[model samples]
Target chain A: MATKKTIAIIGASGNMGSAIAKSLANAPYRILLFGKEEAKLKSLFKEIKNTNKKADAEIIGCAADASWEADIIIAAVPFAAEKDIAEKIRQVATGKIVISISNPLNETYTGLVTSSDTSSAEELQKLLPHSKVIKAFNTTFAGDFSQPVINGKTIDAFIAGNDEEALETVSDVVRSAGFNPIKAGALAVSRTLENMQSLLIQLSIKNNYNQVAGWKILHN
Target chain B: MATGILLFQSITVILYYNNMYEVLFENVSKKIGLTKEEEQLLQTFFIPKKLRKKQYLLQEGDVSKYLAFVEKGMLRSYTVDEKGIEHIAEFAFEGWWMGDQFSFLTGEPSKYNIDALEDSELLLLTKQAEDQMLEKIPKMERFFRLLLQNHLIAIQGRLASSLSNTAEEKYNQLVQACPTIPQRVPQHMLASYLGITPETLSRLRKNISLRK
Candidate 1:
């Protein structure tokens, strides 16, 4: 359903946002990215366009605050600004799918400090009741977005949300990015996926590695 | 006559304060600073429980009924991998709170289990009791919200630490927080909780003490 669709990513000038923008470059989608710093976002667009990809897709940068508009707002902001961005996205994305990729991590980025009940995705759901909120693309490391394959094979992309149709739409986007979409469960299940990132990051740090070669979650 | 009631109420408060000095509740008041009344109220609801090693406080697919505060001994909340290996999610000992937050909040089946890492005692509050306590003390909501907020901060800290700090640094921070936890818990469990292999932890310890 995300085929040739218009997509907007909030907090788009950051590492994860740019990685996502790069991955979607060749997909059948138009990427519109929003950032707090308009000039920085413009530069990000230039950098994205500078890349050579066969998809040759369009990447547009907009000067909208996260507290404002668009369809398919992928909030890749840091955890602190997640709820604030969600509140803002709720105001604009009426009946639109708001994709949340925010991961709540411990200071060490190793263990979880949040109790089971307190996940950013769950809080975003409560904060944005009107929008079709879905959690996806958060589990993958920033470096792994471009190279989704590990050991010469594709890796699983986990997605979950309350709205089934919204979830499927997001899954379609995951597939578009050339990754496997594994529907974990409802949005509450996202806490596990998000938490899994903590476990992975811990392993990465433990092994003295920082890139995708740092760790691998073998789904066999 | 009114003066007598004031004396009685004050006496009651004094009595409640007198009973508050055990291991689990100590830093809780210091860690989060629970009010005297709220502390007394929590004391009334937190049911005491004990678990032997290999016993679960809760199991997967079971609705978690209680949010437990660890009194003594270590507990591990974990999920079993497809290979049947347990991935330790959290480890609690002496004042740490352990429960599947997903199940604790939503009343749904939990994917993780909270098990006693050693012979452990917990002061737990059932879902019903927690609701009643919240109703009885509306401000208790603030207490729990603060607790959640603090936990979120810690989680964020760990995330940042993992990204920026070394394993030794993370381990050092843990040792600072609970100076005696490593000695109390099995090395393997501690390593798992630390997101490292037992061998790595052993090596790290060797590397540190050697430098010392």
Candidate 2:
């Protein structure tokens, strides 16, 4: 077998980060789990190991170190921390796939924090010009990772990236995590995906779905 | 080293036992014949799972992901009322299939709970897998249609019985259909399935024995 691809998850202690890590535990990938809180990272690592004894994962102290050794870097931190993390890992993340999974929701949770002109993913792309920035998983809730099939329908993960190869790679990762990957077009499409998630969040709150709702496009 | 080898051998045996699909193949063969190659291909579509007694296969408020065919042991589907009284919907024995069909078909949250009544082995197939299977093997399409027809007939009969039959008549009909069920299931569960109290079932059984 060929050598497994390495994926570094920044902010691996956070809800989305840990959920993604757990989802990919059984997949054929080497995982580098990093977060600001050392203790949380340690517990997350232990949790992953407990679930899958053969998980190829380890806790790393910093994002840059993890990104340097990784083929794919997932920025699982909040939208507010995206620029700070981009600056931290800019040098090493060049020529690698950097996935932006943050949604820039406003304080009221009724709107986007970012201006209507550009998305968090598009901004991240501008910040790390050399890295292939792909937007994905923002439309999905963290709880859906463990059981992506809601009502017998697999949840759809909308992916957007300028690089076709990067988009395909991210689609494969999303599929491996038990979601149906829908290529929602180029990096600019991330704006629409983010807005879609904001609407879904609002609806879930108003309707009492308890954050278990997800998207599934039905077609002939 | 000897103990380790014994442990490894036991695990291997368990794995081999779990992978056995003979029961599923036999059930399918009764409906339609398949070539050895087709059987091998068909095996890929199903996922084999084991549930200990009392383990839930499907729960209320969750979507039914797979339709399960019982290979061994028994399972029961039930719903709890607002007062916490369980109303048994149906029971699935060996060679029978069970699922929340409404939830599975419509992609909605189920109002039913399916759980193993005994330590059970089942072959589970998802809707996508079923569609692909029918596409690959046209013969399976007939098998499934026949299965659905039979299921509908049974359901209609059950509905009629629930509405019109006496408790005694219902118990007798159930026994006539599944002779082994009375022995396998608890009295209260059988009563619940008949939509009657346990005391009524007990009295009915006693009266029937006296008549015999």
Candidate 3:
């Protein structure tokens, strides 16, 4: 029997981080929940264990400062802490697949923080120069990750990275979670993805969509 | 002969309105295939208005009541910084939509100002009319959603460039995106659009020519 791959989700106590952790819990992989609050991490692990009881997967919880031991690390922390986490985990993240779901939205959520030419994921990659960074899940809401299907439609997960292997690894995980993983070119494409987050957030707040809406790329 | 001339004048008037509505319908249809009934319903939702040069469509501190779609001529949306310097946020010419998204969406007082650069013809849609149109034609929702998506992308890109890119790079990008903007807009307005001083823009242009 082959050993299952390990996936660590940083800031696992947060809505987006925990939702992704819960969604990927059923996959044939070990889930490690990392966060600053130990109690919150433990509770999130418990919830994941409760919901994914039938799935053959192991789960663990640890602090943000803990040494990471995973094949893939998802930095699902807030945009403000992205650089700090990237800098902290740079050593352990080396040669590992790092996925960024942080949207560089301004504090008010009305606009983006990063420039249009760059993205949070790209900044993370620069911080963790040894890690292969891939941008995914930034455009998606935490509300959709629990099901990956909304209104009987498969939500599109726009994945972008310079590394092909990293993209495929993340895409396979996304596919396992019941989403249509869309390869949106390179890591720089995260600019568009993050902007899409701002747009979705604005639309939801103003139009009363309740923050549950997901993007679906309709093609003829 | 008088009746014939009156008939010709009426035909011209019909063609003029048809041309305006035609451009709008074409813009909407590019996203979703709208039925003839949906198109007509969509047309009824818009209130046609014309603004002379330097006339305001939306002013700061006023709630943006309508999203204006330009049928002809140009309009510019701008803001005044703390220093009382005008900064161009967006420039809308033919087939483009203009309004403060925040104000239009939330019915809040606008921080931006939208004014006509030339005598401009626009089709304005209020939130109430938009709601009725969406109810009558659900496909219109998709059109608006796509519009929002595209708008988001463009604004995000602009924000990103302003944050990180050099003034020279920004200038090159603006030129690449709309090659004719410099020719159509005044130097000061173009400088404001680039978030740079007119003096810097002149220097950049001079450097480019010198390098050539």
| C-alpha-based local distance difference test score of model 3 | 0.80
Best by lDDT: 2
Docking quality category of candidate 2 according to DockQ thresholds: incorrect
In order, the Cα lDDT scores of the candidates are 0.71, 0.87, 0.80
What lDDT tens digits, residue by residue, belong to model 2 across residues B1-212?
99999899868755554344777888889999999999877866765555658867788888887798998889999999999999999999998999999999999999999999998877778787788889999999989999999999999999999899999999999999999988999999999999999999999999999999
Ranking by TM-score: 2, 3, 1
Stretches of model 1 off by over 4 angstroms after superposition: A1-3, A52-69, A213-220, B1-212
**Candidate structures ordered by lDDT, highest first:** 2, 3, 1
* Model 1 lDDT per residue over B89-119, tens place: 7778777788888788898888888777687
Pairs in steric clash, model 3 = A115-B160, A116-B160, A116-B161
Could you list the CA RMSD of all candidates, in the order they appear? 24.9, 16.4, 25.5
Candidates 2 and 3: which is better by lDDT?
2
Candidate 3, after superposition: displacement of residue B93 in Å?
72
Per-residue C-alpha lDDT of model 3 across residues B1-212, encoded as one tens digit per residue: 99999899868756645676667888887889988877765666665555658867777888887798998889999999899999899999888999887888898799998889998777777776689789988998899999999999999999999999999999889888778888888999989999889999999999988999
Regions of candidate 3 where Cα sits further than 4 Å from its true position = A1-3, A54-67, B1-212
TM-score for candidate 1: 0.47
Off by over 4 Å in 2: B1-212
Candidate 2 structure quality by residue, lDDT tens digits, A58-135: 888868768766778999999999989987777566557899999999999999989989999999999987678999
